[model samples]
Target: MNGNVPASTRTLRVLTFLATQPGPVPMERIASAVGLPRSSTYHLLKAMISEGFVVHLPEEKRYGLGVAAFEIGSAYLRHDPLERLARPLLAQLVAEIGQTAHLGVLHGRELVYLLKEQPPRPVTLVTDVGVRLPATLTASGRALLAELPPAQVRALFPTPESFVRRTEQGPQTLTQLRRILADEKRQGYAVEDSHITPGVASVASAAVDHAGHPVAAISVTFRTDAIPSSERFLLARRTRQAADALTRRLRG
Candidate 1:
């Protein structure tokens, strides 16, 4: 209701409203929704259109987000501080667990490794910084995916072909993936045994943001038999603790 607010704040409000819409909206609706006067909203839209953050559809008499908005979103993904904040935590996790630890973020249907830390005497692992793996086959990927809405998960894996198998040990269909994700959601963490690499096991937890959306996952991987079955739960608890720490750091 304050008409004298800063331009930057009002602009951000307008953009946020537009982002929640299913499609383009008319200028009148945007102005009413964002509580801006028609004239002021028009001016803001004009400036945004000129800057390529909004596009005006003359034929439909509506406005929609433009390429610049998408670029900004992409930039946020690229510049997110997740890696820098999780680096030392990953190192500590590996030291405590005596296994290789990794930080991964979901990229479409894949999980991209952004950081990896190994113990003083570590086992060789296929997971390395810059490596990408199928989301359904890795604990890191499953951890991130489990936090997402089911419809979003469905969108990410539309067909059976969307499922990629490294070994014959993981989910190969939507139903199976959903089952695995359900178990993860209930357990508060995810696990993969010989999915990405034979004789290797990984346990992971998602690092969520202020909005409770997962921004990344922290995982620890080791030989299947390196840790006894009874103690594996302790490793998972430690991984989840590390993930929660990163989440707190991000929210803080």
Candidate 2:
């Protein structure tokens, strides 16, 4: 609360305050909570809004965390603790399924791979850690998207250009994407076939938080021909189990 504190520190304090709040707060409350002068707080909030770390709802005269803030928090989770915790689970999934497995999280309109585990006989995959693919075209992405609120999903894919096609095989518009998400919601899992890589199919389930918000997706990728149609349900069930296990770990 000292006047000597750096502006950057003050900004972070304001952000932390907004994060702890249940909903958007008035500027006056934010200034008092962060111990900044009202004028300085107003300036800081304007800057944060422009940079997308905060959002100002004009009608309500309140401020809240923005998509950029959520992205930053998600980036933090993509590092050490999440990857370490998922490695063994992914390894176990590969051992049981005899396929390649990966962990991915939504980054804007893309699903960014964070971890990958391969069996002894691995199928060729483009989903290595650090690779990114269109969210609508990948099972892992769909799993995460299906858990998001409909309005948020629309914001992420607002236009035709937002739809990125890696192959000629997946949704190309908002309507198509919505239909796919609807199916994912009802089925409790997601599936993709030859969308990212030809002849490769994937099954995925979302790893959710205690509030049921998807934090990440767990997916197993394999040769389409290798998995018989009759056994696809078993694969989906196993993927869901891995996802549920991670969700429990996160909640703990």
Best by TM-score: 2
Question: Which stretches of candidate 1 lie above 4 Å from their native place?
Answer: 1-80
Query: RMSD in angstroms, all models?
Result: 6.5, 3.6
| Cα-based lDDT at residue 235, candidate 1 | 93
- lDDT (0 to 1) per candidate: 0.84, 0.87
RMSD of 2: 3.6
Model 2 clash number: 0
TM-score, prediction 2: 0.80
On lDDT, the leading prediction is: 2
- What does candidate 1 score on TM? 0.74
Lowest-sum lDDT 10-residue window in model 2: 149-158
Local lDDT at 103 for model 1: 88
